[model samples]
Target: MMCFRQVTLSLILLLLGQATPSRLQSLGATKLRLVGPGSRPEEGRLEVLHNGQWGTVCDDNFALQEATVACRQLGFESALTWAHSAKYGQGEGPIWLDNVRCVGTESSLDQCSSNGWGISDCSHSEDIGVVCHPQRQRGYVSERVSNALGPQGRRLEEVRLKPILASAKRRNPVTEGAVEVKYEGQWRQVCDQGWTMNNSRVVCGMLGFPSQQPINSHYYRKVWNLKMKDPKSRLNSLTKKNSFWVHRVTCLGTEPHMASCQVQVSPARGKLRPACPGGMHAVVSCVPGPRFRPQKAKPPRRKDSWAQQEPKVRLRSGAQVGEGRIEVLMHHQWGTVCDHRWDLISASVVCRQLGFGSAREALFGAQLGQGLGPIHLSEVRCRGYERTLSDCRALEGSQNGCQHENDAAVRCNVPSMGFQNQVRLAGGRRPEEGVVEVQVEVNGIRRWGAVCSDHWGLTEAMVACRQLGLGFASHAIKDTWYWQGTPGAGEVVLSGVRCSGTELALQQCQRHGPVHCSHGAGRFSAGVSCTDSAPDLVMNAQLVQETAYLEDRPLSQLYCAHEENCLSKSADLMDWPYGYRRLLRFSSQIYNLGRADFRPKTGRHSWIWHQCHMHYHSIEVFTHYDLLTVNGSKVAEGHKASFCLEDTNCPTGLQRRYACANFGEQGVTVGCWDTYRHDIDCQWVDITDVGPGDYIFQVVVNPKFEVAESDFSNNMMQCRCKYDGHRVWLHNCHTGDSYRANAELSLEQEQRLRNNLI
Candidate 1:
C-alpha cells in the first residue's frame, strides 16, 4: 500500500505538471524568525524558509494598531491599516489567532501580543503572515559568523583535529602527530602532514620562547619525523614524551597560540600525558630566532700638527726694496695676520721701516692691501726701542712669494714738527724791491693816493692803511715836495682819490681823492686832504640817528656814527642843535664836477661824512642833486631834503596814529600827531589835515619872541628852519607872506595820501 501510495502521488504530480517543488514546500526544516527593536520595513519578511510549511497567526482581537506592529516586526516601514478579508491572497495552512493589540513601542509582534499566536480581527481568508524588509542589515553579525567558520573550517581546527608533520603534503588528509596543544582549553594534536618547520616554529614561539634568539642547537631532526596516528595514539605517544610542552599548535606561521619550544597532541582522539620528562624523543615545535649581526667600530681622527709652529712677522707699508716683513701668498691666495700677536712694539718697527713718523695704530684685515694668501706668520714680538729695520725680528729682507698687490695694508703718521722751520720768513726785514703804488677811483673819481717802500710797498701799505680805515691821500707827489724822486722813479705816484681805507688794497676804496698833500723827513710823510672839487667829498653826508615810531609814537631808536669820524678833528661836527638851510630856483646855477678833478690817485678810495648831529629829533638831506658853485665859488643850491621826524618824546594817543614819509612827492606830512603842551605853548600849529602843498613847520625857540597885536610884521617870528619828511626847495618866499603854495604830488604819493585818508 505504501508503495502504491507513493506511485499514485508521483503520477498525480506528473499529471498536474508540477515538475519542481514549491518554494514554501522546499523549506522542510525549522525556519529562523528575525524580530528586533531596530527592524523596519522594505527588508522583506520576518521568517525564513527551513522545514517548509506556511502558517498564519490568529489575531483574534487584532486591530489595525496590532497589524502595524506586526508589519514593523517583519521589517516594514510604518504600517498602513490591517487588511481583514485576504486583501493579498488566501493562505493554505491553519491560521494562528489570539489576543493581540500593540502599542508602537513593542520590540516584536510576539512581545506586543497577549498570546503566542498573532491575534487580530482577521479571518482565515486573511491569515496574519509577515513580510520583513528592514532598512539595513546588521553586517557585523554576518562577518563574525563567517570569521568563526572560516572558508574551509575554523583556523584552530585545521591543526587541532590532526597533528602536522614535516613529511605530510599540504593537500593530503591530516593525521595526529606526537605534538599536542591546548586550544580552547582542550589538548589537541597538530596535523603533522600539513605543517612545515616554519609553522612549527611559529607555534613554539606562542608557547613562550624568545623567537629572535639563536635556535641552531635546539631543534631535533628525529622528533619532527614522528608519525601522527589518531588522537588516542598521539596521547599514548605523549605519555612517554620527554620534550617541551605547549598549549597550542598551528600550521600557519601567524598563529598567535604557537609555542617556540613546545609539544602538541591531537584533541580529536584522547587526552595528553600527565607528566612528560625533558630530553625525551617527542615532537617539539619551535620558531627559529631572528638572525642578526653586530657592526664594527671606527678609528679616531688625526690631530692637526701644523698649528704648533713658532711665530713670525709679515707685512709693512712704504718700505724700500725688501725691508718689510715676509709675506707668503700660498696657492695664489692671500690672507692677513689674525692680529692676535700685533702690538705697539711691532707697529713701531713697521713705521720705522716704512720711513714714516710713528705708528698710531696697526691696521689688520687687509685694510690698506689685498691680503691674498695663506696666513703663515702667527705671533709677532718686538721691542719698540729698535732703531732700524735690521735691528728687529720683523722678518726683514726675507724672500716672499707675495705679490705687490697682495701685501697687507699698513698706515703711519708723519710728524708735523719738522715742517715748522721751513715756512718761516727769510731774514725778516721786508724786501724793498716789490713796491707798488695804487691809485683808486670811486664813482669815477680818485679818492686815495700813496707811495710805499721796502716790504711796505704801495700795494701792501695801501692794504694796511685800508685795514686801518684810513684811505691814502689824494694826488700823490713824487717830486721834492713830497718825495725826493721823480714821479714813479723810486717812489710811487698817485692822483685824484677819495677813500676811507677799509680793504686789503686801495682799489677797494669807495670814493674819489687827489686834492692836497704834505711831506716829512725819515718817515717819508704823506697827508690826505679833502678835494673840494671831487664829488665824493662834496656829497659826503651820513645819518646821525635813526628812530622808528608805531602809531605816531616812538617805539625804539638807535644812533650810528662812522668809526673814523669819531677820532678826527672833525668830530665836533657831531655836536647837537646845529641848524643849516638853503633854497633856490629849479633852474639855478648847479655844477657838475669834471672827470679830470676826480682821477684815481691810488688803487681805491672812499668818502664819508666825518660827523653826525641830531637836532629837533630829525634832519632832512637830499641824495640826488648837482652841487652848485655860484659865480665860480663852491656852494650847494637848488636842492631838496627828504626826511622824517622820529623821537622817543612823541605822544602815543591812539592806535590809528602813525608817522610815515611819502618819498615820491618830495614831501611828508605828519598824520595822527598828538598835540602836547610844549607844541601848543610854542605856537606850533597842528597841520594833520593840511592839503598837499608847500608849508613850513615853525617853532618859537626864544620865549622872548612873541606875536604883537599892533604890528603885522611883529606878529610873525622868523626862525632858522629845517624841512622834514621828503622836502622840495621853494624858490620864492617873503617874511610875512603865507607859506602855503600849490605843488603837484606824484602818483605813488597820491595813493599813499588816499590810504592815510581812508
Candidate 2:
C-alpha cells in the first residue's frame, strides 16, 4: 500500500515536468546528418543542409576540433576521430565548405570559419567525415532525414577533358579532348546531342576557363580511326562506350557550372545507351585564360658530377635579358658557344637555365652582337629535355670548327605576372592601329610603360593583333615617332621582343629581360596597324571554261604577246601567223571574298613604277597560267606580272570605293573583283607547240605567295582540256577542293584518254 502511494506521487511529479525545450535543442540551429555507406548512425560522411539541399564539407582543413562540433550537432557526446580523404565514402551533391577552421569549444560546426557554402577547390577525394563517441543522452534518439526536401538526383562531381592520344597532352590542353563528367560515384560521358557553344562554355567555366573554342572533331576522328586496331567495333572509345549520364543540356552561356544550366537527363533515350545515334560522343574544347596553367614542380638540380659546376650560364649584349649571346662559365672564364648544329632545342636549355620559358628564336652569326670571349663549346646537341646548357652533349674545344662570329643567341619568353591583361594599344588614328603599352607595377606603384621599337616587325605584331582579337597584322612599324602626339607616349618597359607569329599573346613571345630602356625612348615606341580580316583571292571557275578558245595571231599582232611570252616558244622560231599556233585563252576573275581589303603587304616606298601601264603597281606578279598533261607535266605557260589591282566592279549592295589613283588605300576591296579578260595580253595558256590531245589547264593566283591572305587553297583553278592542234575545248573546271565529289569521274575520264578511247 505504501509503494503504490509513492509510485502515484512520482507519476504526478513526472507529469509536471518543465514545458520549455531543453537548452541543447533551443539553439535554433538545424541538425546535421551522418550519411554514407556506413550502417551505424554515428559513422558516415558528414553532411549539412544548405539552401534546402544537402551538401558535404571538404576535408581540406578539417580536424578533430571541427569534428567535435559536428558530432555534438549530430546528438553525440564527443567526436572520437575525423575521417579524411573520404574514409567512409564519397558524398554526392555540392561540397558545401572548404578550408574549415573551428575550435573545440564551438557548440556547432556552423560556428566555424569556412570557404563559404558550395565553394571549394577540392575533389571528392578530400571529403570530410567524422566518427562520434558511441554514447548519447538517455532520452536522445537518432532520426533519418527525409529526402522530400531535395530530389535524390545525381550531382556532377568532376569534369575531365580526355585527350584522344596520351602523347598529345603537351601540344594542346583544351583543343583536343573528349569531355567526361562524374556522377553517381563514377565518371560518365555526355552525349553530343544539342551540344553547342553554349554547352561548351558552361563546361569550360566549370573547368575554370573563360570561353569555349572550336574543336576539330573530324580531324580527331580521322586520327583516332588510324590509331584504332579495330575501328569497326560498335562502341566509341573516345566517348567511353557512349555511356552517357546527361543529355540535352541547355545553357545561355552565362552559367558558372554545368549544374547551373537547365539539364535534361535521358529525356529522349535511357542512360547507358546511345543518346547520339551518330555514334559520336560529346567533345568540349575550351580557350583557357591566363590562369589555366597547371602548377609545375620546381626544376630539380642535377645529382650527377656536373652538379658541382656553379655560376655556369650568362647572356650578353641583349637589350632584354633573354636575348643575348649564350656564354658559359668554364674554370671561372666566361666563354661563348659555337653555332655549329645550334638549334632551338639547344637554345631552350640555355633559356631555361636563365629561369625563362622556351627559346623563341635561336639566332646564329652573331645576331645579338659578337661575344668578346673564346668560343668554349661547339656542336651542342640537346633534346630540349635538359634543364641547363651543361646537361647537353657538345664538343669541349674549338675542334668542331667554330668561331666567335658563330656564337649562338637566344630570345626567351618573358617571366612576368599580369602580362596578358596589362598590355594596351594607344596613339593611332584608329583604335586598331596603335603604339603598344603595358602597365608596369614597381614596388606597388602602377604606371603605363611603352615597348621599345627596335627589331619590331610583322611577326611580333601578329601576336599583339591576336591578343587584342583584331585578327592579323597589316603592318608592324619599328617606330611611332611620327605619331608623337599620341596617348601611348610613356616610359619604355620592354625591349628586344621577338615573336614566332604563332603565340596567342605578346607576353608569350621571347624578350631580352626586364624593362631597361634609356629614358624617353618610349616616345618612339613600337606600333602596329592591324586589320580585322585579310582578303582571300579566289579564281572564278565558271569563267575559265566559258572563255576557252584557240587564238592564232599573225607575227605583227603577236609582237607584244611574243615579247611577254604569252605565245609558245615555237612561235619565235615559226613563220608568219605563228604557224597557226593553238593558244588556249581564258579569263581570270580574282575576287576578294574576305572582310578587309586585299592589299599588297609592301608600302608606297616599295611600289614599282610601270612604264607600260603608266601607273605605280603594288604587285608585279599576280597570276600564272599553265597548260599541263594529265601526268602533271607542264607543256606551256603564260605569266602575267604587272597588275593594277582595283575594285572596278563589286558584288550587289556594295560600291567600288578603292582606286589605284588614291594611293592612300590599295588592294581589291571586299565584295569586289579585278578581272583579267580572256583577250588580255597574257591571259592565255600557250598550247601552240604541240598537237594537244588531252590536257589540264591550271591557273595560280598569288603564285609567289608574296602577300599574306586568309587562305591560299582557293588561289588555284584547274580544268580538263582537249586540243587537236587547231581547236581546244575546256570542261570540268573547278577551284581547289570544290571538285572532290567528281574526282572519280576525272579518274575514269583520264583512264579512257590514256587508252585513246575518249
How do the predictions measure up, each by TM-score?
A: 0.16, 0.38
Q: Name the candidate that leads on TM-score.
A: 2
Per-residue CA lDDT of model 1 for 289-379, tens digit only, reads 1111012312112111111221123332212111222343222222344332343335545443333323433433333323222454444
Candidate 2, superposed: residue stretches over 4 Å from native: 1-201, 205-464, 476-528, 565-581, 601-616, 659-667, 739-758
Q: Candidate 2: worst 10 consecutive residues by lDDT? A: 1-10
lDDT of 2 by residue, 713-740 (tens): 5678888888877678887676763423
Please identify model 1 stretches exceeding 4 Å from their true place.
Answer: 1-64, 70-76, 80-97, 116-127, 132-163, 166-232, 235-758
Model 1 global lDDT (CA atoms, 0 to 1): 0.28
Whole-model Cα lDDT of every candidate shown, in order: 0.28, 0.62
TM-score (C-alpha, index-matched) for candidate 1: 0.16
